[model samples]
Target: MLTRLELAKDWVRDAGNFLKENISSPLEITEKTRYDDLVTNFDKEVQEQLVSNILHHFPEDKILAEEDDEKIKFDPEIPHLWILDPIDGTTNFIVQKDNFAIMLAYYEFGVGKFGLILDVMKDKLYWCDSHKAFCNQKELESKKMSLDKSLLGVNSYMYRTNSGGLLDLSHQTLGVRIIGSAGISYGQLLEGKILGYFSNLQPWDYAAGSIIAEKIGFVTLTTSGEKPRFNCREQVFTAPAYLVSEIQKYIKS
Candidate 1:
């Protein structure tokens, strides 16, 4: 019998392979909110496959996935839950054919146990299970970068809000990047390519990545500096603890 952790890892690998097999085919795409926010047939197909696979293997486990509107409101008191993002960078997958991910996280009684973020094109996977994080099996460490030295990610939508706090954080960081995918941005953070990521993200987008970041000593919290609540309607930010502290000053100032 596969241990729970082993089952999670196998599911991720199987899903990644499924994605790669279909990557080259023409996709049936549709707009979600706008032309920029897209949903592909593959996205739904993959989500269904993942949800089915997990449920079949672990009928008692709760699952929350991106394509479904039915939220799995598990008792935080429950021992096991699975969070999945079948295709994290759907825009990139549709237009650029690269930079998307299959992300998954496992939690035991509200505590994160494992995280997997797979870069489908690069064939690289980032993972952490209790002890350490690895990129393609090479162990990774999160280094603290000062605000001025940090590379920050801001959702393009935030640019429209004109919140002074957002503007100030953008100015303080070493640079700002608007990656179309939250999973990719979080993957960059895990690989130490970027110092911080701030966005108004949904649960599937952040759940898996947050687990990896927290396991490797990065901070995952809301703008209010509280632990993020999954399946909620609130926005959250994940970053290095020092950078988060620096950004919070702007929010208060």
Candidate 2:
């Protein structure tokens, strides 16, 4: 698993560099479910490159990626699975050319073994295995802070709609941040910059980040305070275990 983790780290770094190199180049962008939910030519290209590399090195491992709808299956028979989000903050990538990330997670027999998230613009590689989480290869210590004393990350959609009482929840925090990228948000959490983050996120969006965060004492839960299912989208709340119940109180049914 450690060897595979190293290989994944290398692949994600390579992909991140590709994104950086092409930031100034022209890209063919298209909307997915909404105008703001975008994908670019680079997104597809990066996904293809990472997927091809994974298959080449680990042919038997199943792959689940954001760009390919056909491979979005959770097969119990596949002991090893790789999940990839080639460009996590597409809107930010298109507009700001920064704040985006590349995320990858590996699961063996339904247990998360390794996870990687590369903050492309900053060149920070946040990764974890079963035992520890690190940023740029430096281990992160566990952090615990009260909601009233720490900043929180809430997605724009949820904040705008006040979904699940998020507006009220924000009032309890020191402040709120909306990064628009789960991977980047997770990195902040791992670094103790934010207390927690909640958003309706897909598997690839939260999988890698959640794995890395959990290793450092965070727990990922559904809005209603259940473990999230990996097969579909869920309102995921990730934070230190001590803060889960307080955050869940504001999550309305």
Candidate 3:
């Protein structure tokens, strides 16, 4: 019998394998809202697979997945719930064929228990619990980095359009990276390659990574400095502590 954590990890690995096998093939793509926001057959397939697997194994738990139109409302009284993003960087998956991820997180009454962010191309899995974070089984620790030494992640659309208070924050960082995928940017933050990442992101983009970041002793929050609310419909920005404060100042100025 597998524990819940074991089951979650296995599901992620299986999903990643499924993605790798299919990623190179021709994908049927369609635009959602705009050309920059994309969805593919593979994305829906993966989401369906994950949802079915989880529901089959844990029927009592609630699920919040990106592909579904109707949100699965959970009673806060329920002890367990799962949040999933079948493919975090759908546009990247459609365009570049790399730099995308399968993101998952489990929470207990709004308290995060475990998180998994699998970088499909690199075949690296970033996972963590309350104790620590690991990349491919190697323990990871948060490193201190200042604004001038930092590399920040912002979406190209946000940077170009100056949407949602992003332009001022972009200018303050040492350098800005329009990575197109929040999952990839989150990996960069965990590996110490980047100091911060901020953008108007959805719950799927930030839930798993934010839990991992917090576990490893890094600060994770919205640009407004509020802790993220799980199953939220609002857009959010996440980053390390120093950058959050710095960017807040920049936005004010």
Candidate 4:
């Protein structure tokens, strides 16, 4: 597990470097569902590299990736599964040329064994192994602070819905930030940069981050307060325990 985890880290870093090199290249962008939800050719290219790297070391592992293609498969008989979001913030990558991330999580029999999320622009790599969560060489501390006192990361759309009460909770925090990438947003949580993350994200978006969050004792749950399951597309919230409770106080669902 240690060897595979180390190799996963190296593979992702190399992938990030690939994205960095192509940032300035003339490119094409298309909307998957809407203009706000974008994908670039580089996204597909980087994912191919990631898959190739993983398969080189562990070809038997199943792969679940955002760019869904016939080439990857899910075989329950296989003990290892890798979930990937080759580029977590495509808009940021295309528009700002920064604040994007690469996320990958490896699971063993449905349980996340290790995860890695790299902030490509800043060269920050956040990962979780069997025992700990870290930003580079620094081990992260478990969640331990008041919700209102902690910096918060939230999706701005939460303010559009009155029933969730996320809008109200935002007012109670030190501040709210929307970094566009769930992987990067959760990385901030790992470093204590944000006290919590309140966003609607799918499994690939949150699975890797969840592995790190769980290790650090951070809570990953539904806004209505439910256990979050990985390897499936669903809405999820990863945050401190207190902040979750605070948000749930107003969440009608």
**For each candidate, how many residue pairs have backbone atoms clashing (under 3 Å)?**
0, 0, 0, 0
lDDT of 4 by residue, 1-253 (tens): 5588899998899999988888899878988888698888999998899888888888887888898754345444559899999999888899999998999998887778988999998999999889988888888888577866877787777756633567777777787888888978988888888887877777788889988888888778877677665545445677766556566776534
Candidate 3: lDDT of 120?
Answer: 90
* lDDT winner: 2
Instruction: Quote model 2's TM-score.
Output: 0.96
Query: Scored by Cα lDDT, where does model 4 land?
Result: 0.81
Please give the ranking of all candidate structures by lDDT, highest first, separated by commas. Answer: 2, 4, 3, 1
| Tens-digit lDDT track of model 2 for 60-129 | 8899999996865766566999999999999889999999999999988777888999999999999987
* Model 3 TM-score relative to the real fold: 0.91
In model 2, the runs with Cα more than 4 Å from the true position are none
User: Which residue pairs overlap in candidate 1's backbone?
Assistant: none
Per-residue CA lDDT of model 1 for 104-184, tens digit only, reads 888889888888888888888888878888887799886866777768777776644734366667777777788888889
Per-residue error for 1 in candidate 1, Å, reads: 3.2
Best by TM-score: 2
True-vs-predicted CA distance for residue 236, candidate 2, Å: 1.0
Structural similarity to truth (TM-score) of each candidate: 0.92, 0.96, 0.91, 0.91
Cα displacement (angstroms), candidate 1, residue 133, comes to 1.2
Candidate 2 weakest lDDT stretch, 10 residues = 69-78
Query: Comparing candidate 1 with candidate 2, which one achieves the higher TM-score?
Result: 2
- Model 1 gets an lDDT of 0.79
